[model samples]
Structure formats: structure tokens, C-alpha cells
Target: MATSTQSPLAQHWGYYLNGVEQAFNWPKTFILFYSSSTVQKSLFKSLFLNGVVFFGGLLILETFYNGPEHRILGCSYANITGFPMYIALLGINGKFFTPIAEKAFEKQAKAHPRTTPGSTNIVQSMASMIYTTIFYINCGIFAAVLRSLIPHAGPFLSFFMNCAIMAYYAFEYKWLYMGWTLEHRLTYLEEHWAYFLGFGTPITALTFFLTTLHSGAIFGILYPFYVIMATMATPKPATPYGQPLTSGKGTPTDLSAPNKVPIFFGVRKMNDLVISLAKMMGGVQVDSIVAEKQKMMKMD
Candidate 1:
């Protein structure tokens, strides 16, 4: 008797199971990620500085101002609370967390040295930095232009744009930590598109909604805890894509020695898409196009 093939959903039950497993393991993983003994000194130093700035500023605002309600004059207490949160998290991450993460990564690599030395991680880190920078710049410009064009739809547009940005902020740290290049990252996103959207969308929406609360000062103080949980919940990286070409029958080729992968770093498909778009737009002669529009307006 012939056996029936399982449905796609059944075939992919492992992904769902793994996701559940990760969820159950989250608290343990979070503690492990933060509890590294080597990071104590830098972590404490950052925490001390963050506390001084955040609390000291709040004290000054409360003392000299007309009243607690108008502590910062025109600015709401929420703004004071929120901005300091941003500074503390941003400062700590930049000053200590990143270096500590790198040190941990390096220690792991040294302990179990790669059989093949690959510069893919280095190239990926650089590409991720460039890609993130360009992405944020373009997102800001696009949002500004689009908001101007559709002022009536400002709230909806702002929320939509912010959701996309927040989603990236949630997972980009995991991508960086896992040493996945933009290409690998995109491919994993493609393959697990549904999972990623499900994971990130709710967090984005929740974060956006939290800013609208009247007691945002209290909520703002609690916001970083949500961020910490989101970071912890990020899944492990997908397996790296192997070299396309093979040296022998069904044998995957390894090019780690020469580091040829750096030449094709980042999301090449995205680059191609951008180039194609540029080419199409560039075909229009701007001066002549402007002249034609002017002539048509004059004729009308």
C-alpha cells in the first residue's frame, strides 16, 4: 500500500514546535545572555551613569519648575521620561552592551575555532551597519514626503511607518549577534516570512499604542522591560546558505580561505531591485520633463 504525503502544514510542524520550545526557554536564555561575568564592570559603570543622568534631570525638573504638572514647562512629564529612557538605553547599548557582546563572541570563536576561517561575519557586520543606516535615512525621508502628500492620513501613515521601523529594531540586534549577513538575513526572512511577521507585528503595535497613554511617564519607565523581553525572544539564526557551485558530484564547495563571499556581501537582490528602479526613473529627462509640464500649464 502506498502512503499518503503529509500536508505542508504538517510537514512544517517542526518550525512551530521549535518556536514553542524557544518560548518556554526564553527566561533562561535571557538570564544567560545578561549574566556573563565578564560584562559586570562595564555594565555597572553604564548603569551608574544612566541612573545619574535620568534621575538627576527628573529631580531638577521637579524642583525648579512652577508645579509638578508643568515640570518641564511646555514639555509633558512623559516627554522627560521617554527621552531619558532613549538616552539610557542607547548609551548603555553603545558604550557597553555591544563591546561585551563582541567580546563574548570572540571568546566563543577562540574556544571552538572554525575549521575554515571565514570573513563572512566581518563583511556581514559592515554590510548590516551600512544597510541599517541607509534604511533609516530612506525611511525618514519617505515618511516626511509621504506625510506631506497625505496630511489627512497622517495618523495611519505614521503608525504604519513606525511599525516597520520598530520591527527592524526588534530583530536587527539578533541578526547582528548571529553574524548573519544581509543576504542570509533576507533569505531567512523570505523563508520564514509568516513567522517573522507574526513575531514582530504585535510588538510594533503594542509599542506604538503605549506612547499614546496619558500616564506615559509610568509606561515609559516600563517600556524597556518589554524591549528586553523582545530581544530575548528573538530566535536563533537559520543555517547559512552554502556556496552555489560544487567542486565534485553533490559535494558542496568551500571558499572560506579566500573569503570570496565578501565580494557579494549584503542583499544583492535588494541592490538589483534598487538599480532597476533607478534605471527606470533615470530614463526620464528631468529638464525636458519640467519644460513639457510648464508648456502644458501655459497652454491650459
Candidate 2:
């Protein structure tokens, strides 16, 4: 496939289409889900816990509080319910999701073993996970700010930004298993922005229009399936399509890939600021942990 004589434009579009294809690859998702006991157990736990229990509770509350007499109260609660539920789910579902992600990684590794597989002690793993969760929250806030601040184009910009974020979330487990540093993962995703944008479009589209609480519910139900898909997917980055630009004097000048986009720049800066503040308050220094992990990766 790499030796193909396709034009850069054609290859770029092919990568985009590949992402869209992977997103809808439900047959593969079902196959993996049913074939692995671990995957099944984890998914069932997610469905029952997040879906049936948490979302069900929300529905019950909404049903009772949705009448006109409680309209203002209901609307206000609806707006705020999703944020708390999101935090709660992160705490509750991390264990279940980790197993699912591990199962997916194991399946993929059997087919194609990684040369530099990641290994971290429990402490490092916990620190990294906490840092990732906080970064994700910051990204969410950044997207919200973008949507509110810009008038006509803000929502659209926010939508694409979210597509990139969702793509990262789906693929993060696989990358982590492969021992990618957080910076490396974010850099790669931003560089392959076009492919991820297409990959994440389906999920973002599904949840984008719903209320925050409802969106969170739907996302909880659907996220596990996407994780499987991401594990199975082979993302064709746009780096291979770097066509050099020629000067008027016929000298080749620019050789940069066209698809490199700094989609995470704003959110990353925000996350860094938060991390710095936390450290100033004598909190865990995630950067030091990350640097240690990177050093270990290099040594290995």
C-alpha cells in the first residue's frame, strides 16, 4: 500500500475515507465484543452500571421534575446534571473501561506485536491516568468556550475540535498500550488531523445535538464499541502525502505535510496551566512522572 503511485491528494482523501470506514465497522466491533469474555464482561458492566443505573436514574428524575410547575427548576437541573454525571462516570467506569481497553490491545498485539510495548508500575500508571483525565476535562471546557465565544463559526469550529478530541479518546488506549507518551499521542493526532476528523465524525454527530445529560448517556453506551474499532483501525497519516512545492525559479522549496493542524494547542496550554497550578499547591507533579516514563521508554 505504501508503494502505491497515487497522487498526494488522492492518498489524503483515501486516508479520510479509511477513517469513515473504520467508524462504521460494526461487524468487527460485534465480533470482538462477543469473542472475548473479558470484553463482554466489561461492556455488560458499562451498560448495566452507566446505562441502566445512572442514565435510568436521570430519566426518572426528569420524568418527575419535567412538568410545567417545576419547569424552571427542571431546566436548570438539566443544564447542570451532565457535568456532575460526567465526573461521576469517570470515577465509576474507569476500571471497567480499562479492562475493555486491555482486551482490545491484547487482541491487536496477537495479530501484530509491538516492538516497544509500554510498561509502567502501578504508581506511574495511576499518575498518568489522573493527568489524562484532568487534561480531558480541560479540553471539554476549551471546546465549550470556543462554542460560546464565537458567533456563527464558533459551533462549527467547536464541532471539528470535538471530532479530533473524540478520535484521540478512542485511540488513546491503544497508544498507551504501545507505550506512547501523552505528548507523542497528541502530536501524532494533530499531525493526522484529517483522518481523525473523519474517524470521530460519527460519534460527535450522534451526541452533538442532544442535551448534555442525554449526550453523556448516549456516549457512555456507545464509547466501548468505538474503542474496539479504534484498536482494530490502522490510521494512514498524511505524512506520506507531503508533496514539495516548487519555487518560480523551479527549485523545490516546501516539503511539509498539508494535514498538520494544531487542534489541541489551546487545550494543551490550558491543561499545562492547570497542572502547574496544582503542583504549586503541592499536588502531584504529572510532568515529572511523564518525563520519567519517557526516559524509561527511551532506555527500553
Candidate 3:
């Protein structure tokens, strides 16, 4: 009697979560969130803080010595199709999305007095940029050392392996339930899935190669991943580790039982949002246009 609902979304999320748990199993897939936390927490903090210094170091060199004149927000090729788009997608969040996060940080700290929340936007952004830099640098050295050790490695082979690993994780997030559906846990996994999609595109490969080999071509590629991340991100609900929003209509199993927490985005933004009749998709493109930019940037 309980088999009626939307096609894919109809199924309750409890089962969905089972899939998530299996997917994040570290040994099964080396690409995972825990790998990010392998370092001592204090050392991790120091690493990102140092990453901030490293970013500054590069910027300093560019600004004074080499001309780090390009804006992180600007693009060399401004489309979602190219290899560069991948890096822009990932990197743009630090430049553009950090503000929304910072606001949340301030509010969250005040809301939960005793609870120890994570670090600040400044730190998180530093972490992303810093870690990204580190990954690329490491990748470069590995490429160089391995080339002499195993010169048989080629672009096709490297790309194939990267794609294999990345595709597995990406699909796992889309279809599998990798964790408990508790809002906190769900939210955590959502970020892990959405951001830091490792080695997904050629630009990603380039960044890694450039960092280790000092290849300028590889260096220019990091921007698009950041851009795509900011532009294409599904405005994930603020809820953490959400499985199914418990239903509270009539039956005892109603999830609307608790004072329902608000959706991440407020009505102000979604209000009167336009949708296309054909696509059934409304709202503007994820690309940061003039209007979205002004609003997000708070610059009139």
C-alpha cells in the first residue's frame, strides 16, 4: 500500500544511506574524506595556515616579480565545456562562495555556545587552495620521478586511471548512500562529494603536472576547477547528512515531528524564481552573472 511517489526520489532515504556507507569505505576506495584528515589536526591547521602563506608567496612573486595579476574570479576560457572549466569550478568557491560560509560561521558559533565547530572561512579557503597546491606539487614530482622509473606511462594511461578513480567516487555519491542520513552526516558527505573531485579533468592533471614539473601549462589549469565548483554547485541544502526528510503528514513515521529546521536557502532568493516550462528547470544559470555577483559580493 506504500508504493506511491516520484520515480527515483520516491524511495525513502534510509536505504539510500546504506549505499553511502559502503562507498566511503577507505580501503575499498582510497579516494575518501578520511585521507584528508590523516595529518594531526594541529598539523593540518598549520598546513593550511602555511598554505595561506604559500598562496601569498606565489601571489607575492607574481605581484612583484612575476605579475600574479589575474583575478581568481576571472577566466581564460569562460565555458563549462573545457578542461579549464573543471579547475575553475573548484577554485571559485574560495573567491566567491567563502562569504556565505563566513556568515554561517559567525552565526553557527553564536548559535552553539559550547560545541566546537570547525575552522573559519579564512582557514577553510586557505585549506582548499593550500591543499590543492600541495597535491599538484606532489603530483608533479611523482610524474617526474616515475617517468624515469617507468617511462612507459603516457597521457592516455594517466588519464584513464584518473578517470577510473574519479568516476567511481562520483558515481558512488550520485547513486549510493555512503553514510547515515542524519543531517550533519549527510551534509558532510555532500561537501566531500561535490568538492575536491580528484583528477576529474585534464586541467586537473595539468595542475598536478605543472606543480611538480614547473610546467606553466599545468599551472594555468587550476583556475577552471574552482570556477566550475562555484558556478555549477547544486545549492546543497544546509541540512547535514540528510537522508529522507522525515514525513509528518498523518502516519506515526512522520519526520515532520521535530520543529523542522529551515532549508538552507531562504525564500528571499528562491522567491519568484523563474523556471523554464520545457526543462522544468527554473532560475538563472549557475555561472556568476552580473546580478548574482553583485548580490553575493554585496557590491552595488
Candidate closest to the true structure, highest TM-score: 2
Judging by lDDT, tell me the better candidate of 2 and 3: 2
For lDDT, the strongest prediction is 2
Q: What tens digits encode model 2's per-residue C-alpha lDDT throughout 113-164? A: 7523574222255656666666788889998998999999999999988899
Model 1: per-residue Cα lDDT over 198-231, one tens digit each: 3444544555554333222322332333334334
Per-structure clash totals for the candidates: 0, 0, 41
| Candidate order by decreasing TM-score | 2, 1, 3
The order by descending lDDT is: 2, 1, 3
lDDT of 2: 0.76
What are the models' TM-scores? 0.45, 0.81, 0.24
The candidate with the higher TM-score, 2 or 3, is 2
Question: Candidate 1: RMSD over Cα atoms?
Answer: 13.8
Model 2 spans with C-alpha error above 4 angstroms? 1-10, 68-84, 114-116, 120-130, 242-257, 276-300
